[model samples]
Target: MTSAEPGAEPLALSGVLTAAEADDTARAIAGEQRADGAIPWFAGHHLDPWDHVEAAMALDTAGRHEQAAAAYDWLARHQNPDGSWYAAYAEGDATRPTDLGRESNFCAYPAVGVLHHYLATGDEAFRRRMWPVVHAAVEFTLGLQQEGGQLGWRRDPDGTPVTDALLTGSSSVYQSLRCALALADLAATPQPDWELALGRLGHAVRHHPERFLDKSRYSMDWYYPVLGGVLRGSAARARLAGGWDDFVIPDLGVRCVRTNPWVTGGESAELALALWTMGLERRAVEVLRSIGHLRAEGGLYWTGYVYADEAVWPAELTTWTAGSLLLAVAALTGDTATRAVFGGAGLPRGLEADCCA
Candidate 1:
């Protein structure tokens, strides 16, 4: 499949991606999956639980259902007894826990992928099979939430919780919690406690600036709340616009950080998804077009480009980067499951805090 020309016509809302490109990208991602089912950042690199799930979701988007299930099964097999996976595992080696810490966001993300897979396949058996995994992971994640509604980032190897909340990480967990609730609904189970946790987490994301660590320079912290469904409508639009000049490199893509000249495929693709979520299809198409420079010959994407140096940096083709692009394209093309997950359709709205009560 030939790559879409950058700055071509605005992508069609129903058929945004060419069939060939989607298939190639899916193949690229699949090639990176190990025999044990882990999709690492790249061959020989370490796999983080969060990025592994991201890649699996992309595989599901690309119509590779069985491969996606295998990815989840790897997570299930490796999950610690307390419902967490270590922060990182060595690529091609499931037995090696490269980082022993268990991150809240990473543990929670599998639910999002599991639910997305269920939506794509309508596999009741798969849904039932993954229910316990999702349940335990959500419980493990919520166990780390502080009173201020933001979740603690991770636990040390010795089981001590690190209580600082991260804006980007917590925003991700917020989305996962929503997906977890959706999964529970599908399974005929309800989680009132998680619903409350979702509400408070949203409140903290929207109103409690002090609750999270200050990482304003990073683009993810700026746009993740919107991408993760914590912010919506005009507020999300304003947030995107507020950082446009600082993070976006016109005709290049979104920068990894405000001060960096590096444009990352994953961040650029995520911003496109966020823009699409806000009904800015034209702008979203443009944002996605700008990232075309990152696509490699095999349909996998390079991690990032250093515009100042005029070279691709890191020199690695990451599974999650390609996955992010596929997911964004899926949303742009109006794929039903992609739309449902990102658009929060049929997902429960949590209770609002009653300040007066």
Candidate 2:
């Protein structure tokens, strides 16, 4: 599907991207979107709830309002009775789930997307329609929150909880809970319990590394707390500084894993977002620009480049990589709605105390 006519003004990122290029990237993501609204990583790839929502939010940043709404509608239709979605669906087809596990972070992500759509379009009716969906999904996710405030990662197919928590996943959920609370406030249906949950979750993300599994080797684990808005000010700065040398490759973007030579577009874009969250605008722009080599001809991005091998390891382009890049650019360019979501100034910070203590 051709997303927009040729002559539209570009959402240019100064020297990094042009208007036409931005629209092409957004259209590329839209083109990969299935008839039922699910957006896989690529055509014929499995669709996961978390990345699906990310792609939808990117569409919103690009002013693809109708497509974004359709993505959310797809979620509403496919959500399990208990509010979670299967971790992966075959080729965006719900009937052919590739993974039966239900992940807490993945289940919680639609709240971010729904709220982003509402912020971008001022669609009160859409927000209202999605209210219950967000509510139920949050409830299902928080049901797995450990007593220490960190959230259990997922539930197996048998419905058994995987009690161990993941730093990256919990950090993402921190942002999602805040977004859900924001939605709750807007809908005039305040959730006091969510506020309390947010507090505990924040405490875990901010101070309790021992409670989460050790995945510091991955870039997401290193920076998600900041990107998710649970870490800020001096703490966020220190975290980024500590990991910079290990994960970042100066002009080539960020490595997906500390021990690997692969630089992924998604991780690089997200790190840019984390830097932007800490008010490092110039550095964020540089980081975004560093991955320019991954930009595919049609506006999508290759998944990752192996610098050691001097090759793009993943031949396929991914919607989430493009989505992440668009959101980062939108945030950096001062797009009001994107800034409101990622900038964390407008979103409510539920009681911020150590509820677990």
Candidate 3:
């Protein structure tokens, strides 16, 4: 994604897109959005809150702000009084699965996403509308936190919330907290509970490895703290370096699950994002070159290659897959304060300390 012809505006980081490519991508995705704005995946794929948000971010990056906003509006409208979204929603021809109850994390990421949109668009009305929902979601996570300040993973309809904080899940929560506080700040709302909770969660991430339940060897657990700005400098260095061997796959790309026979486009793109965050410019560049592996039939990306690269599995090119690539590219190319944080090299003023705990 760097300049080979020298200069070229760093290629948009979501990889290069012409006005045509951007439009086509947006139109295709926008076509999937239901009248109520629950954007489905591809055509028949079910709507998922996580994937919906991810897709909306991609739409935003693609200059499809209206469509992206519509997607966010859908989330805000459907959020429960408790600040949570349905664990899973019916999508397209798909109905909600009986197996899942409302998930604790289902709402966490989208609230943060709305705030990100607010940052880019400077939409006060949107921010104001998004704040209480963000507060509720953060409040929901608080109820699930153990005395040790770690979060639970899931919630059941009729029972206690699952009490294990996943490493990546918690990392996401850590990110959502900062985003929530930022939304509160933008609206001049003083959320002392958010600040206190963010700090406790930060401390837990800083000190307790045992607090997180994800021991599976995944690239996200390795680089997310740094990628999400929860880890920095020596801590960032130590965390990423510690997980190196488990992720990289020589000339191919980063592997997905260790036991699973997969190496993926999104995972590799995310690594590029994390490396750029941690100031690994050269490594990130190499990754940018390596990412051609996961490119898809329509020039989109199939999630990953399975069976030792024999084929691409679960063959779907997702909006969030594209969204991760876009955000990673924004890190590599943009110069905002967020770029500094996501680059994992720095955090904004006073943000590094006494903030997000």
Candidate 4:
């Protein structure tokens, strides 16, 4: 919580974000929140459920607990009767659903946000209020899980579930399931079914590449398994090293996709968190430092910079990018709640395949 500004100096390996930078970014993100509590990608942009939760988590990191809680309340209010949300909303306007498809990963992310918020504030009432929300969302998400352990990416606008799975999305869902299970444990509600589901999900993520869509060119598909805690130990390290040269640009941050020259703030920050989770703090600090140029004067972050074109391609500031950066910094500074959420501390590991085999 040092009040240092992010200047030219190299960020300290132990504390990559200063209090000023975190506060500024948090305030900037807060500004994007609509009256209804939805945080859009930016003002006038659409809001996706997953990214909305990500930004809310960052608000918690910055000690903006009220705003963070409001964001969750927004989710609670807007949740579909079936425990899902449409893929995207028009600029936080819940009345205008831009995409009717219900994405499993997006639906499940509220659990992560709720757990993080409760951890940060130690508010049992908030946890109690959000419990049913978490339960319903997880149920909806798990309903879409294929027998192979990979989650179906989305349900069609007509409510037909897509059979295809996405590595990155399912990996994210894995983390969400873990968080949901943690919440259940805290509430003294054990979900044996979820623990069983987690095992199959983890087994699929770590062992069944054929079950998911081939998005190996995307950096998320490469790093998400590690970031989501589905991969660990030597396996996680090896997975990261395998993609290091292809996605990581020295001093420029991480590329969004392997073939793209675009280095995005969100992906870079996420990779930093992944590295931190793997106990590679030095590399994590370096990755976080590389994205410093994305920071705007107001502390919001531009979506990406295209090194090949020497331009910011998206020409937009995104709240999720800022959120990711804040979360990464939170992990680096050893913020107990943030660390516990990301590091899987005090969280159930779920059942292993052998347990049910």
Candidate 5:
């Protein structure tokens, strides 16, 4: 491709992460990995299963399938008997600490990671191993669902539920449920509860946001529904369009909070991924331009801005921040260079009419 007319370079880090840049970022994140295979946000913090899974997926996108699977195996080794992962694990191979115990979302996310690993390798054995985990996790998670159909955010090791459902948290559970159902379908397991759970969640997401006890000021609450395929058709299209004025800056990408001046790498990058999944390629490019200010040296990304001030409030460069950007980039461009980092897979299956019913 020729040079831009005058100022055609990518305007944001969302898209500005060149294949080489992405490679470096991916490697840097990988370097932080512990001997036990958990990837923490930075060097010192404990590793949560979700971040490990995201980083693993990033590895897949970067074409490091073996490394990615090892991450998954790390998760598999720590997999709870009830089909869940603990809320957090200490970094490295030493004795793991479970101060936070198990989290619902953490437990559910691995279903996606395992399914992706299977897609990349066509390993039925992995599928066989994960199939029961996926089912038990979904079943256990569904028990945390409230009467309003929102999911509880966490649980004690004894299976006692913690906080009420959160919009973003449940959105993820919704995604996991669909992935679980897809696995069940492939294995011919026929999970009626899985279907029922997804259907209930789709309704909560589409019809009753208030039911979710929503503290959804973040951009994650903005596009993840669409990205998760929980929203579609005219209603989905409208939600995507409606958020533009409040959350997006066509030139700068997305705001981290709906009312805040802060724009963050993780939020913007995730928004791009959501848009790309929705087939909004040009808009995804816009998000990419907004985050271009992100630096290449930091294997991590700025968490968010203080406002239009351009100063990063959260000075930390999180692994998931970079991971979100990579996943978004791969989906937006279908660029083969990034494709090798992950499997050449389509979006996970969305819930059908009676997914939860």
Candidate 6:
């Protein structure tokens, strides 16, 4: 795969990962990619659309463009007739479905990956090739959006719509929608409905948390609106401050849930991304550094560490964990595309909704 420019600055975090270490981490993620380009949580683990795209974006962050493009090509080739992917796939044979559900966020995430790749490499052919895939996927996801603008989590295997929405999932969808619109602009095909949907979704995320499930105990719910670009300015700052003590443990990392004693690499890195979006660079770097314990010998990070039990839970090294950290580091190290995507500076804000209504 193509690499970054030889004279570029390294994605190194002081007192944490060096340039070599970062390269090793990227390679560790690439190693988990299947021959067909699917990246499972770990070797032999089930592949989920959301995590798969997350890992692919990381490859692009590390200048693994060819590998990342292959990953997107795999998604395009295997997409369902309805433009959505199954929730989980058998790692051994990704063409075989493991979980038959279709998550809206999972279906919508390819837009983010595609847009990131396009921004990173300026690949016009790649953008055109994936346009229809992204279009259909966004349509499938928006079909599940409730009247309040929050999207239902998923469709059952049998095509049943479960109308309950998730704050974190829909927040993620909000971010993906913005990315899709960015791609749409590049393709010269505007999606006005998507813009309206974006406004409603943003309102649901910012003003109507009651519309979503009470997942306040989860750290993602605490930070995803900020990370997902729906919440910002003083409101974003206030949200992070409110939840910092509950979720972040000093010298550890972010916990997956409020009551849990385990700190997960994925969530921690994602929090760093949120912090970086807020221009809190020092906090973001510190958050990234705190999770150094989860970095295993092979450069892949453990899924999480259970500080209460003094053990690494699940005994697994995940590509997404490393992927998330790489993305955060990429943003921190002045990767313009990564910064633009996560920072919400270049992406459209969509139509604004009347929150009072």
Number of clashing pairs per prediction, in order: 0, 1, 4, 0, 25, 0
Give the whole-model CA lDDT for all candidates, comma-separated.
0.87, 0.92, 0.66, 0.88, 0.69, 0.91
**What stretches of model 2 exceed 4 Å from their correct place?**
1-9
TM-score of 3: 0.85
lDDT of 2 by residue, 139-166 (tens): 9999999999999999999999999999
Q: Which regions in candidate 5 have their CA more than 4 angstroms from the true location?
A: 1-15, 92-101, 335-357
- 174-236 per-residue lDDT for model 5 (tens digits): 777766766887788787766766777777777777776656687778777776667766766
- Candidate 1: where is the Cα deviation over 4 Å? 1-17, 354-357
Q: How close is every model to the real structure, measured as TM-score?
A: 0.94, 0.97, 0.85, 0.95, 0.85, 0.97
Report the C-alpha lDDT of model 6 over 1-357, residue by residue, as the tens digit: 535444445678796689999888988898899888899999988899999999998888878888899899999999999999999999925568999999999999999999999998899999999999999999999999999989999999989999999999999999999999999998999999999999999988889988999999999999999999999999999999999999999989999999999999999999999999999999999999999999999799999999999999989999999999999999988897788788878898889856435
Instruction: Show the lowest summed lDDT stretch of 10 residues, model 1.
Output: 1-10
Residue 356, model 3: Cα distance from true site in angstroms:
14
Tell me model 4's lDDT, rounded to 2 decimals.
0.88
Model 1 Cα shift for residue 318 (angstroms): 0.4
- Higher-TM-score candidate of 3 and 4: 4
Angstrom error of the Cα, residue 345, model 1: value is 2.6
Models, CA RMSD each: 4.2, 1.5, 4.9, 3.7, 6.1, 1.4
lDDT of 1 at 351: 63
- Greater lDDT among 2 and 5 belongs to 2
Residue-wise C-alpha lDDT for candidate 3, range 279-304, written one tens digit per residue: 78778867765666665544466677
lDDT (Cα, tens digit) per residue for candidate 4, span 129-241: 99999999999999999988889999999989998999999999988999999999999999999999999999998888999999999999999999999999999999999
